[model samples]
Target: MSGFKTKKISKNPHQNPMQVSKIPSQKTGFSSKNTPENQKETSENILTSADKNKRRARKISGIFLIISVLVFGAIFAIKAVGNMQLSNNDEYKTFRQITDIFGDNSETPKTPEKRGSKNILIAGIGGRGHPGGELTDSLMLANMNYDTKTVTLLSIPRDLYVAYSSNSAGKINALYPMGQKQNEGVNLLAKKVSEITNQPIHHYLIIDFSGFKSIVDALGGVEVNVPKKIYDREYPNNNWGYEIFSLNAGLQTLDGKTALKFARSRHSTSDFDRSSRQQLLLKAIKDKALSLGILTNPAKISELIDSVRNNLSTDLTVGDLVDIGLAFKDMSNTNILMYSYNNECNGICMPGSYLYTPGRDDFGGAWVLLPENATRSRVSRYENMRQFASLVFEFPHLQNAEKSIRIVTNSKNLSQAKNIRKNLEQLGFPIDHQNAIVQTGATIETTNIHKYYDSAIGTGFDDNHILVEALKKIEPSISQSTGTGAKFATGTGQYIEIILGNDAKNYFQFKGISASMTENNNFSESNKK
Candidate 1:
C-alpha cells in the first residue's frame, strides 16, 4: 500500500463513466514510460485495430457482392422461364408441324420465283368465342422484294365476293371457315389469295383478334399518325353491344384494344378507310418492333413470345422468321408501299379504285365487292386486280418515282383522253389532272408520248424503256418520242405528256371503266368549253 498510490474513478456526469485514472503498480512490473518494450506493444495494438477495420470492410463487401449475384441470377431465371414457355407453347408446336407438312422446313426460306420476292398472306379472324370467328376479317398480301429491299402490302377487302367452291360462291372472308371445315383453311385461303394477287403465296400467317391485341400490348403499343378523325358511333363492343369509339387526327401511341377499334371501325367510315387504317397500324407495328430492338432484347422477346403463343399461327419457321427480320432490319418507311381497293362509285370511284360493290340484290341480299369490271355472273375475273398488283409489286420503280403525268387533247378527243387517264390512274399512275390543259385546235392525226427530261428538276423518266413496254401493253400503237419534242416544252414540270390525237380513238378499252369524270370536277370544269 505504501509503494503505489491509486487514483479514484471519475463519477462526474460530464466525464465518461468508464474512464479511470491509472494507478502505478510495482507488483505487475509494467511501465508507463516510453521504453522500447512498451513502444513495441503499442505498435502491435495499433496494427491489430487496423486489421479489424479491414476485416469488417471485407465482410460488408462480400455481402453486397452476393446480393448482386443473386439478383442477376433471378432475372436470368425469369427470362429463361419465359423463353421456355414460348418454345413449348402448343400453337408454336402446331405451327412447326404445319410448316413441316408444307415442306417449308428447309434451311433456307422459300421465296417466289420472280425477282427473289416472297409473298406472305396474312389473315385476321375473329377467333374463338366470337361470332363468325372462323371467318377471316382481314386479308393482306405482304410482298417482300429481296433485290430492291422493298415491301408492298396489298389489302384485300373481306367483303370481296369469290368462288369458294366450284358450285358455290360467297364473300372471300368466308373461304377460311369453309376450308376449316375440311381441315385446310390456311392452304385454301392462300390459294385463293394467290389467284387474286397473281403473286405466289410463299407463306401464310393467321391470327385472331386476341392474338393481335396481345402482340400489340406486348410491344408496348404502336405509334400511328391518324390522317383524319375517326368517330364511330356504332363500334362493336365486347358484350355484343355498340359503343362509340373516337380518335382525333394526329400522331399518337395506341394500345391493343384502341388500335383494334381503330382498325375495325367501319360504321362511321367506309371499309376502304378502315383498310387504310389497318395498313397504317401494321406499318407502325413493324417500325416499332424493328426499331425498338424488340428482337434482340431478351425481356421483350419473351413478352412477345408469350403474347403470340396460343394466339398466333404461321407457316414461317423460327429460322425463317429470323432470316426475314435480318433481311428487313434496315428497311425504312419509304421502301414500303401500301395499296387498297375501294368502291366509292357514287358518280365515279376515286382514282386507282379497283373494286366496286354490286347491289345486294344480286348476291342473295348480301353486300359484296367484285372486280370493277366483273359482272355478277363472272365473279372470278381478277384481271384488273392482278394488273394493279403487278403495277405495285412488280414495277415498284414506277410507283417510287411518283412522276406526274399530263394528258393533252383537243376538244374532239377530250373524252378519249379522260378515258385513258382513268385507265392509267387505276393502274397506279400519278396523273396530274389538276394542271391538265385542253388545246382547242384541230385534231392531230397521231398520238405521241413525249418524255420531258429535265436534269435540273430530276423530273424525267428514268425507266423509259420499261415504262414504254408497260404502256404498249395498254395501247399497242403508243409511240415514244426520241427526244423532248419542241412541241411539248419541258417547262410544264410534267414528267410525261400524252398528246392525244384523233388516232387515240383506237386505244384499247378496259371493261368496267366508267366514263364519268365528275369526281375530277377541277379538271372537268376548268377545261370546259
Candidate 2:
C-alpha cells in the first residue's frame, strides 16, 4: 500500500538572527497609469508587503525570545554546577566541618556569655615537606568582644612548658603533634590554651606555613612598618639549611615569602620579639584584606579558597567568619591590644616579663619559659599569667586608652612610688618611667592622681572615666584631680601622674596584691644604704 506524503514548508526565510530577508519588487511589470485591473494588482501588492513585514517582526521577536531563554538557562546551570563543585570540594567540606554548617544542633558555634566575647586559638604550623611540620610555630589567642568592639591578641610563646599528659610534660607547641596521634590536635591544644589563659577557647584555626604564604600572596601583599632593621643570620630554608634574611627599618611592603621569613626568624632576635612581629604581620594582612574588599569580591575569595584549600584547617565556619567580619568591620589598629610574655624586664617583673626561664636541668636540658611564681609541679597554675589575661580581656578600654603614666614622689615615698609602678604595670597600665621626675623634698600627706590633658579634648579618653573608676576601686583613697602638679612637668602628650605622698604607702597593699620579692628587696637595700 502507498502511504500519503506531506510536504514541509519553512516559515522562517532566514534561520539566523543576524540574517535579513530581501523583499522583491517588480518595477518593470507594474504600470504607473491608473486602470481598473492595474489598480487591483497594485492593491494586492501592497497587502503582500504588509504581510511580509508582520512575518519579519514575528521572526525577530521569536529569535530574541529563544536567545533570552538559552542565556538564562546557561546562567542557572553554571550556578548549579558551581555549587555542586563547592559541595564536593575538599576545602569546602573542611570549611563546613569547621563551621559546623550542617552538623548537629548541639555542636553549633559557641557564643560566650560574658559580653558576647569569642576567644579563638590561632596556631601556625610548618606543614608537610618542612622540618617539624606537625609542631606549632606560632600560637595566639584572639579575643573579640562585640560589646566593646575591641580585640585582644595574646601571643603564647612556643617554648612555654605545659603538661600535655598526666605523666608527660612538653612545650606547648608539641601539644599539636601529640594530639594528632589521636586525631584531636586542635581540641587538645585549645583545651591546654584555655587552661593557661583561664578563658574558654571558642574555636581554633591551624594553618600551615604554606597556607600563610598563599593567603598573603592572594592579598597581593601586606604593608608593615618595621620598627628596627631585621638581620637574621640563621633563617631556615626549605632544605634544612640556614640563610641570611634582612629587612630595612621603615614602612615596606612584604610579599608572602619575605613575610614568612620576617615572622619566623628568631635566631638573631628573641622569640618574644618574633611574636610581636607576627602580630604586626597579622594586623597588616587584615588591614590590606579589608581595604581590598576581599569579603565581597567573589574572584578574590575564590583565589583565597584555592590558595589555602590544602594548607588551612579551622573550626570557624562560614557563618562564624561572616559574623566576625561584620563585627570588626570598623575596627582600627587602636582597638586591638597586642601582648605577649617574656622575661626581658630589668628589675621587677611586668606584663611582658610575666615569664622567666627556669634552669635547663629542670626541663631535660631544654630551655623553656615558666610563668613567674610558677613551680615545676604546678606549671598549669599560671596565676600571674591568668591575671594578666584577665586584665587584658576585662579592662580592654584601659589598655586601649594607651595613656602614659608617670610616678612622682619624694625621697621618703620613693619605695611606695616604685611599688605602685610595679602594680600598675602588672595590671597592664602603660607606665612612663623614662620620663618620670623624682623630688627629694618634704613628703606630701595626701596621694593624688593628676590628669595632664583635658578629658574632653582627646580621642581615646572618652573611656577615661572607666580608668578613674577602676583606680578608685583599687584604691578608694586615691583622689582624682586634673592639671599637672607643680613637682612634675606636663608631659608631651596625655598622661596620668600618680603623686605618691605619705598616704601612698598604703596603696596596693591589700591582700593578694603583693609586690614581687625583687622590688621589696631592692627597696629594703636602698633604705639601708
Candidate 3:
C-alpha cells in the first residue's frame, strides 16, 4: 500500500477499457452514512448537470445583454472576497513549499527539461484523537505530467505486503503506525512507495482524522453513492477502536461529519469496497472544490491552509502548489478510475490478517506475472525499493520437448542480472538508474495465474489475455526421444535467477527460490483442517 489520494482530470479512460492503478483506502474521503452507490452515481450526474447548468445560465444571460448581470456581479464579488482570503492564506502556504524562492532566492524551473512533471505522494494517517499520528491507512501516487496534460494516478493498497526501507516487510498500512511517533511516519511511507514505484516523490501530505474531516468541511460537502450495505460492530473512532457507525446503501448527500464516517468506515463491503467508496467521495470533493469560488479567496485559503499545517507534511514549495492548483483549477469530474488489489496476488487470506503464500506444484499452467510491455513502465516508476517478480514461466518446446523451466531470480545474482540487463536492452526499455530495492525472503511467489483472473477481486484483463497466451506458447526443440526432464536438488541452496532472451527486448525473469516448494492440494477452507 502506498500514497492513494484523489486528484482531478477530465479524460474518460474507462470507456477505452481501463487498466487501472488502485486507490488507497484512507485517502478516500467517504466516512459518511449517506453514500450509497446509487447516490454516488447520481452525484456524479449532478456534477455534469451542474456544468451544463452553468453553461446554460451564462449563455441565456449573455444573450439578454446582462439580463441577470446585476445578480451575477454581486455573486462574483462575494466569491472574490473568499477567494482573496484563501489566496493569501499562510496555512496553505505552509503546506506548499515554494520551490522557486525558499527562505530567499527565486526563479523556478519553467521548461519541461527543467520543470518536469513532479510526483507527489500523499498518505492518509488513521488514528483517533491523538497528536501522535497513526499508520498510513491509504497510499497514492499523484503524477502530474504537465507536458502531456495527462496525470497518472496510482493507488496502493495498505494491505499489500511490501518491503520497507527499514528492511521490514508487512502490510502497507502499518508503515505509518510504526513510524508516525517520530513525525517521519509519512516520510517512511513515501520512501517505501518511492522504492516500489521507482518515482522520486517530491512531496508528501499527511492528513490525520481531523484534517481529513476539515478538508471535506472546507469544500462544503461531498456527494456519493454507497455500493453496499455496511454493518461494522465496532470500528475505530478516537482511542476507542470498536465504536460502530451504521449506514444503509444508496445515493445521498453527506456533510463533513458524515463524510468522514463514510470515508473511514470499514462497514459492509470488503476493505477493497471501502477503498472504492473512498475514491468516489474524493472525486465529489474535488468537483465541489473546483466548482466553488472558495478556492479563489486568498484569505479563506490562508485559514484553510493554516488549519491543516500541523496535520500535513510536504516538500512542495508555494509556487509549485499554486501552479498545481491553477493547472487543476478547472478539472471536470468526468473521468476517474478506481480499483483494488485482491487476495489472489497472495492466494487465500484471513479476515483482517494473514496473506498466504503458496507452493509451485499448485500452479496449473505455465505463466508469467508481469506483461512484457508494462514491466519497465511499472519498474521505473517504483524505483526498486520494493522487490518485484518478473515471473519466468518456461514452456517445453512443442511436441513434448524438454521439461518446463521456471527461473526465479532476485536482485542478487550477478550473471542473471547481466542476462536481465541484456533482455531489457534488446527490448529498448527505459531503466530507472535509482532503483532502491531491498530484498527480503529468498523465495519468490508461486501463483496459479489462471486463478488470478477468476478471483472474486480480479481487475479484468482483456489485453492481458494475450500476455497469458504468449507465456503459454513454448517452441519445441528437435527431439528424437520423448521423456520428462530430470529434477535435481542436492542440499542447502541460496537463490535462483532465470532470464528470457538475450537483452531487455524479449525479457522475462524469475529471480528467487533456490530450492523448489511443493504445491498444496487444498487452499480452500474446507480442506484446510
Q: Per-residue lDDT of 1-529 in model 2, one digit per residue for the tens? A: 1111111222332111111121121111111222355365664355455557754654443343334335553233233222222111122222211222111132335567334677778889887667667678899998888867888888999888765543345677766655555445466677667656666666667788888998899999899999789898878777766789999999999999999999998987888789999999989988998998755554564566557645766655434554576668789888887888777666644465677788865554556788776655555545566656766776776654455667778888877667667766766676555655445576578878776544466432222466665566566776767753334745356556677777776676633322211111111112221
Tens-digit per-residue lDDT, 351-409, candidate 1 = 34877777765554555788765765556666677667766776655544444566778
48, model 3: CA deviation in Å?
51
RMSD of each: 28.6, 25.6, 19.5
Rank ordering of all candidates by lDDT, starting from the highest: 2, 1, 3
* Of 2 and 3, the candidate ranking higher by TM-score: 2
Instruction: TM-score for candidate 1, please give it.
Output: 0.72
lDDT-superior candidate, 2 or 3? 2
Relative to the true structure, how large is the alpha-carbon lDDT of every model? 0.62, 0.63, 0.41
Give the clash count for model 1. Answer: 0
Residue ranges of candidate 1 with Cα displaced over 4 Å:
1-115, 345-351, 397-403, 454-459, 462-477, 485-491, 505-508, 511-529
Clashes of each: 0, 1, 92
Off by over 4 Å in 2: 1-115, 165-167, 347-351, 397-413, 435-463, 469-506, 509-529
- Residue 204 lDDT in model 3? 63
